[model samples]
Target: MFRSLWFDGRLRAVLAQVLIACGFAGVVGWLFWNARHNLMQRGIAMGFDFLGEAARFPISEHLLAYQPTDSYGRAFAVGLANTLYISLLVIVVSTVLGFLLALARRSRHPLVAAAATVYLEAIRNTPLVVQLLFWYSVVTLNLPAPRQALEPLPGVFLSVRGLFFPSVSWTGDLVPLAWAAGAAVVLLGARFVYKRRHRAAGARGWPWLALAAGLLLWGAWQGQVGLQSQAPVLRGLNFLGGASFTPEFSALLLGLTLYSAAFSGEIIRSGIAAVPRGQWEAARSLGLRPWTTLRWVVVPQALRIIVPPMTSQYLSIIKNTTLALAVGYPDLSFVITTTINQTGQAIEGIAILMAVYLSISLSVSLFMNLYNRRINRTQRP
Candidate 1:
């Protein structure tokens, strides 16, 4: 009976899986034991109590007011915010820039295509760190001093120090407009749902151009009620009242965006190209203009292909934000490393960093997986 079970393919597969799991568990157990023994021998403690200790160093820019006297917990929060800020900016900007690059590469004109190819190659071939340094060492360095900073538009200044732009000052009156904005968004979403469900029954084909005009008019009308612009005025050696992005941040953001944009463009280009050429021909035969055909026929089909890989790009940008340390921007990694150096709690600090990054990655992956599943179901005939 034992020999019969061993010889059966199903039984063999189950046994193989069990053996592999046991081996993995054993190795992990051994590693944990070894690490604990080593820590005991070295008389080093491992705990997160240091998180509440005072952080005696300063951060250049933080979303919240932080002092050298603030606890490491607060300091870490600052770093986390900074990392998310940069990562979010990079993800949005890179995706937009990448789509434009892909479109440029798909251009019928050879000049436009050639320009895009050169851009893709140049950014992709170079090391990201080098690109970051170039922006910091070369681009920012060559900018005029604060006194002579360029103000091409009122309230926006560009200097070697960095970009200084007007910051929004909100008033109580904007609350009603904010509520209206939410309602408008909900209405638009409902319209999309209605349109999709009755796509075949749509007798009133609202022209895309008219829809665009209506949206613009609505936005303009809304803006008149509560929106206002405040421009920065140059004062002292630096702009005091405006929101600022330090040179290091600007460099890191630009470098990361341009670098990742190359890959994003390639991913999208392949996705778009994978759509059968006959699909485009069919849309054209149905009397659709280029933009209309692309919007209605091409993008919907291309989204299924594009979204899976785009998730990876989004995660990559999140991870790549750690490279901010190279340019003297204190992201989460930078803060954790500094904590380790200051307190000699290497194990604890490293553990915290790993946990935070893992959490971020898993959260992003979960959201993307859900989105991918929804797309797959919708695409099914």
Candidate 2:
């Protein structure tokens, strides 16, 4: 039996793979040991113990409350929150802008198509870092100061400081507001499930939107959710009261959105083009309007083709957020850099950064893959 196993091609292949794996593991172990030994000889501790120590650094733009006295872990969390906030904003805004750009390019009008083509070419050809620097300069140098801010709307101000807009403040019982939000989620979930169950009929989005709006109104009437919009006012040297986007954040977001939108538009346009011409003809023959046909027939089918490539685009967007440091936006990478400089725990800091990014990329891939499967299954006969 042993002689036969050794001679078998399949068994030999398995043995080869096992040996390669063991060799790779051994090399990794040796490298890790060598690094640790070197660090010890230099009288430097190599571990995650630095994470518990006080960061003693200030993060200029953080979603979470943080202080210099906060632990390194808390500082990391703040930085992570900022990174996620910008990334999500870029993803959402870029996707919508991209879809619109795609539609514009596909438009029969010569002028519209030409304009979109020019925009796409300009953005796609230029380096993103250069574009970011340009935006940063524009925001910080070209824009007027707070006292002379541009008021594009009733409650919006644009200035060197940032974009300030009226923001809603909820001033009511938290429990009822939570209940209302939960109910809205359940309604949306039910709509999703119903569409999944009945693929042919699918779902109409307006009904769900109306339901959520009605819930909000009902909550307002019952005093369960009291929302007041606070507008920014010039106070001292800056705008105060309403929510504001720092100049760094505004420039970074704008740069990312415009840069990514170009690629996303091309991806969407290609997907739309990939849809069989017969499908469009069939919808038109059924007396459906062009917009209706695109919405009900083409876009849904195009989504299957669009999703996979779009996943890579999204991952790119997440990774590109590391450039936020260039414009002084305090993203995770920025925090990591500061942490390394202050704590001198370069290895641990870098390891943490790698793990965070890897986890995020994997999560995005997993979600997109599942969505892709669902779309494929839905279209299957």
lDDT of each: 0.85, 0.93
Candidate 2 accuracy as lDDT: 0.93
Candidate 2 residue-wise lDDT, 126-169, digit = tens = 99999999999999999998899999999899999999998988
- Among all windows of 10 consecutive residues in model 1, the one with the lowest summed lDDT is 200-209
| lDDT digits (tens) for residues 114-216 of candidate 1 | 9999999999999888888888885467999889998878778899889889877654455455655566666666667777887745545465435645655
Off by over 4 Å in 1: 1-15, 173-229, 378-381
Q: Enumerate residue pairs that collide in model 2.
A: none
lDDT score, candidate 2, position 215: 80
Error of 1 at 179 (Å): 9.2
- Per-model TM-score versus the true fold: 0.83, 0.90
